[model samples]
Target: MTANPLAPSWLAPPADANDLAASVWPANARRSAADELVFAGVPASVLTERFGTPLYVVDEADARARARGFREAFERECARIGTGVTVYYAAKAFLSSAVAEWMTGEGLSVDVCSAGEFAVALAAGVAPARMGFHGNNKSLVEIDTAVEHGIGAIVVDSPIEVERIASAAERHGRVQAVRLRVNSGVHAHTHDFLATAHEDQKFGISLTEAPGVVASIRSHSSLRFLGLHGHIGSQIFGADGFEESAARLLGLHHELLAGGAIPELNLGGGFGIAYTAADDPTPVDVLARQIADIVASECARLGIAVPRLAFEPGRVIIGPSTVTLYAVGTVKRVTVALPAAFETAPDDSTDPSAHAAAGHPEPATAVRTYVSVDGGMSDNARPALYGADYTVRMANRVSAAQPALVRVAGKHCESGDIVVHADYLPGDVEPGDTLAVAATGAYCWSLSSNYNYLGRPPIVAVKGGAARLIMRGESIDDLLARDPGIGSATRKASTAPAHAEPAPAQAAAQRAS
Candidate 1:
């Protein structure tokens, strides 16, 4: 089979389009004897039939295992240096009450960045001391809330946040533990938008300013300094950036020891994961050992004791444990110009002789199929936001047809509302086919929106052949319930004629079902 000239260089024609890459899917994902895709023993067809299309299916066992794996890996490595490690599940990746419970049950702390996340964790019964609050622009109310709840540690992003946290702690008549976030100037090999520790980013204060901020934090009677926090970026592949950042942070940590005791150091987590067959992310255990050695050696070089460690891993734990399932709504094949590097001999169908007879020029072209799904940017915006690439496969059943290059699109109004940028699916893919996008468990739901009035999908956790809704999908009514005009009109029209029909959104939703 010839490779598609239009496909990305990193994408290769698979030996079998139906085969699932183990690294890019949940641990329990497999093709059953019936050729149906199953996650955690629940078939994809069963999940879509029960939960509807455009659903987020998470493998409960896979997620829980990752959480436990991270905790164990870090603990084991840090134990070599006579120190302990705290693994904080970064809630910004994907958080629900069930996920919060799962993480905590695995003995991992929760790291939340906003008031809503903090509230969700609290409601899920996550201990206040096991939750760390983080945000660059945390409002006074947020600080007050964190202090009121006696949160574990508030990561202060700027110098002013130190005072804000201190004021809030003073008001609560308690001393709050705080970590000063600093940019170690390590340029991680990642997208510019994902890199946070670069000097010009919005996330943290400069390494030069961190010392003064730490002094100010210690000056406050209501604040206890918990050392420094540094995050390089998201979706990072190797530990080179982490090692460099650790070396820089340790330099600061050594200097800070002159002032007072700094017990714990947090190297924020941006560990990467395999999103496609082309990705080879460092395993968690290997990453733990590599980073542990880097920090230990750096501390030894600086003649400073290794501080207790903390990490905030979000995507690495949750990203590969779930998949987004969508129903194909349309399929269109369009002729596109092939790259010059991929130019080939003119076939009879596209030959200059046939073109001349038809009054057209011979073109170096290839057919690219665009498979439109029931959902798009409204459900997963990573493609539009970061130009993120994802892999897709026919989930309802396996196919024996030849592989065809495909662009999985969404039903949104925008042209950029792509789901999978480029991948190969069975040539027979058509409307009503269930397509599953692998490794969508991280930011898809967390960054979802209501663009084009599309209702957000639900997240279902499947385990032991049992599926349970961890988060309910939003309906049209849920979207309209917040509109003042719609609510008022609905209430006023309640006394109208009995033959009146349902709202347009409701009717469309009913027809969709």
Candidate 2:
């Protein structure tokens, strides 16, 4: 098959379809002597036999290495620059008791955005003083829970939240450490939805409003202002935005601390990880040094004592440590009409899927293979949600067949439920073959759902040639257990919208009754 016009320019055809790119795959993923894909000494076939298809496999060692890398790199950089640093594992990426326990063992703190995540951290034996709670709109119960637990820092996002925390802390007879979240007004070069630092987003208080919010916290007897925090956005590959965010944030940090001492400055994490060959993520050590130099330079120039620096890198640590395994169920060949918008399409496109569509004639269409897998948007929604890209490989065996342009899709009914929009795969790919998608360790499982009523898959941890089910897949019984029986007399009908009317079947049943 010829080169695909729909394939983005950044995507190059793989020399071998069976080969997995090192940047996106787990550190320990490799092919065994038998030519079967092996991860952490466990073969893909063995994992499927035991855990079933559509399973999330985490390389325990890879995750630990990443955790240790970030911690060590930051500490080393901070020491060289004569500053202190703290590395927090962002639990929003992928969190479980085992993962949290590993983080604690590595001497890393946990950053959570919800009460459930906080509880998980505590359950994993993470010290309350080592946990940070972050959320733009936390409920009163969540606030009270954090206060009662003596959380290390509650990143106060709004002025109203500062008051809520103060009240909650007073009730608990404790002084809470708070950091005012600030928007630096610098937009990160990423998907617009993921770009945060801009003032228009709903993440943090504006740069203009932060000083007053800080003063409000200082007035509360039950609150102690820890410092200022800023998170530009996620999947960021460059240091310019971090430096910019820090420069603006430190100006405020310097101004506020000159009046009163604040000990910490948290530049929130959005470090990027490679999802495909097109992605080039900054190495942890390099990123650490870049940030360290920026902070060191700023503090020295301002003639202020260096405040403790902190980071909350979630995706970078876990994203490359895991892969989603699916069992191919069906394969089809479909011809798609080339839309009129691509009439002037360049032979070298930056992103092949980055095209506008207007219906074109059937003669201009192209035929591509569609490989359907058991999992879809329910397991990994990034593709559907953000037009994210991922790479996949045939994991069951090494095939010598020539590569073909293919689209890996989910079993869901939605046409947009694509896992891999376009990729080169072995032409011999078939049903029952195991397929693996790279860099899914971050948001895939964390954002998974039971859409189409499909049971969620399990997570299997692999280390030292051993594979264990860290989380069990949902069963039909488990799904139904939470569902109130449809005919239950005690069940009350939920209030519908005022403009809503009963369905035809429901109205007919009501009339018959």
Candidate 3:
């Protein structure tokens, strides 16, 4: 069958529906001896039986390898050019105590953007001095938390936030290291919402305002101005944006240094990763070389010494190392009428079925299949939030059936709850089969929710043919614990206890289960 005209331009039917794309999948993922998809030598069948459906499996070896690659590549490039560099794992992509520990063992720092993220880093035994706190808006309590813990640097997003951090630092009797985030007005080629340094976003201070903000930070004795930082956007593919951002930042760095010395400069991370065949991401070594060359060239042109450099990569490192496995629940076929003349849907009706039922005239009808899975946007909100595209493959077994264009949907009531908008699956795809969605390791779990009262799925890490749960699944009781209205039963106790109640040991155990 030919590619569907209604599908997005970037999507094309593969020669073989069963053939997995190597670019988007984890490094260790491949067809096993049993002809099934395996991650780190463990088959998807084994994972499904042991952990059940709607499971997230991380190839631990792949993740560590990527981390090592980034660190080594950056270090090598910086050393070749005689510049120092640090690689900070962006915690916003996905953070767990174990993951943080892995980063620590790999000799990488962390970039945290919230108090909770900082707490997670602390819980994982990561030194506070190795972490950089970032966010556009930092509440006084959060600023105090960072100051009290002696965080390495707090990336100030606004002039007002600079004052807030300074006040908190003074209150704690500590000198806070700070970096001012500047919008370079460079637009990266990506989704509009992910583009940060485009001058209009809520992320960083505009280039025009950054100089004044730096002076404000320098005015506060409690705040130590580290350097200037610029992040163009996330999921960036080309080095053009990085180079442009570096040049602009270096220009500002030259101006800022006339009075005082700047020790460090941060070119923020928005490195892109392959999510589907449409995406072709730059290799870590190549990206490092490109960035190093650009920074080195800028510094040479400006006749200034290279400052200590750092980058926070969250998606590129984590995105390809994980896959989400969900079980097919239902498959329904529907007839869609092709639009006449302009290929536009009627403004009066948004529902295809409703429009058809109304007996509207049409040129032709196209039959499409909807494969519904047990999980939806609650576990991975990227699809609903940003229309993020993902690739899907049947993981349990191999088949020779012809390709069938299908839309993989979630169990949620919302019509926008789609996982894979368009993908070619085997015609024999059916219920009880395991479907693996590749390149979901980045933001899916980090942005998951408990919507519709459904428990968040557990994350399983696979290494050396071994599988272990890194994070346990949430239970109904776990959700109930936060509800104050419900005590021992559905309702609160009628009488108050004279003594403090024993820690809900049984409830805790149930949640663990």
Candidate 4:
């Protein structure tokens, strides 16, 4: 059911694995004649040399392509199924003024789960009416801010939030359109997405009580019920999950109408994206078809008019469109007894980071790669959080050297702060070589931190021969500013230890999983 480490992944050898896989890389990503990987034609060497190690590079084209895919999916599905669709790019995946413009420009609306995210959208000139606010435990201030800004609609989770939104909207002399986030109790099969539905995690109202919730919304003259929204989970691979969640939601919609509540229904989005070679995510067009099919069929079965369909996708669109470029800071080799249990494959094993519902195949890893970089969990937490392995390659130069066994780690002061669990990098791997990791533009930067007082990297959008900074690199002064009180009391951690790097552990935990 899962790939064996001994067998390499299909995209093995990695000769051009460093070359931007246009499908997974930014639109402008390419390699220069000098063998330097160019994002938007801007060389990786230039980025690291100018900005230093652990720099964040984005392809403007990649970001835009994802936004456009969502827009196009909605449009095409609307034309086919006749049910209106609104694609809301979830800001939590990765939000920035520059990215906000890209999403809105593609005709996609923004989904802000918090006041801070809303502020970013509104500040970026995203129209208030194009925003859908959602949060389970929204702060009173967040609701107040959303209402004050007149966001398109606030997806209400709990009754407390409803009362707050009502009061806030009333204060503004406006009835905020509200959507009830209903949990359908579907055990959405996913890694990061499963907990959202465990009833233990803070999220939507349960499906059984959604009618009463809808009734309450209808009773509030100050509240306008836009519809019912259901997000089962995230990183979903196909439409079966969507169809099931929609079916449950449509039944609730029918009951609401019978009780004299005609609210719009939103089958929320949690589409998956490929983070590795193994993932085979459905195309936006295919996803659109499935969504439209469910909505149309459900509307007919329930004898209810089709309401506007809405989706919130953060990863699906952004995941493949970006990759993280890192420079190999060190390489070490060690030997340890292979776990006897894993020496032979587990009969029904799984990779937690693999896109849900995708096919499984073996990987070629006769020799695995253990490559360490200057960054770790402090930069990209996915690998350490979900055992998310990545495909890496030499970007700064073409290497004829054989791929070596390696484990990538970060400089975070934690032993568990690993990056790629196992990957193949050229045996010639050295401190100066550039290592390109695909599908990183989504979660990597958004979740990065400044552990060990290490400065965060600058974010640059690469397009052939042109790179612009969206977020600037953190300077030593920026780090010092946080601790003016400690500047005199603190000294950089012992440099001798920094120089005498520890040998890479042979059997490090798969922290990403």
In candidate 3, what are the lDDT values of residues 340-362, reduced to their tens digit?
Answer: 65344433112334336456644
Off by over 4 Å in 3: 190-198, 341-362, 490-513
- List candidate 1 stretches off by more than 4 Å: 190-198, 339-342, 345-361, 488-513
Model 2: weakest 10-residue lDDT segment is 495-504
Candidate 3 pairs with clashing backbones: none
| lDDT for position 326 in model 4 | 65
| Candidate 2 residue-wise lDDT, 1-513, digit = tens | 346666778888777888878898999999999998999999998887777778899999999999998999999998898878888999999999999998888879999999899998898889999999999899999999999999998999888898899999999999999888898887664433233445887888887788789889999999998898888888988788888788888898888875699899999899898889888877878989899899989988898888989899899999999998887777887766676555534332223443435554233445588998888999999999999999999887888887878899998999999999989998778766778999898999899998877778889999999999887787655565578774445445432211122333443453344
Candidate 4 local distance difference test against the native:
0.71
Candidate closest to the true structure, highest TM-score: 1
**Looking at candidate 1, what is the lDDT of residue 244?**
81
- Per-residue error at 505 for model 3, in Å? 32
lDDT of 1 by residue, 217-307 (tens): 9899999999899988889887888888898899999998999999999999888998899998888999999999999999889988899
Q: Pick by lDDT: which candidate is best?
A: 1
Candidate 4 structure quality by residue, lDDT tens digits, 211-313: 7777777777788988888887767777777777788888878877776655467777777776556667778888787788888888888777888778888
Rank ordering of all candidates by lDDT, starting from the highest: 1, 2, 3, 4
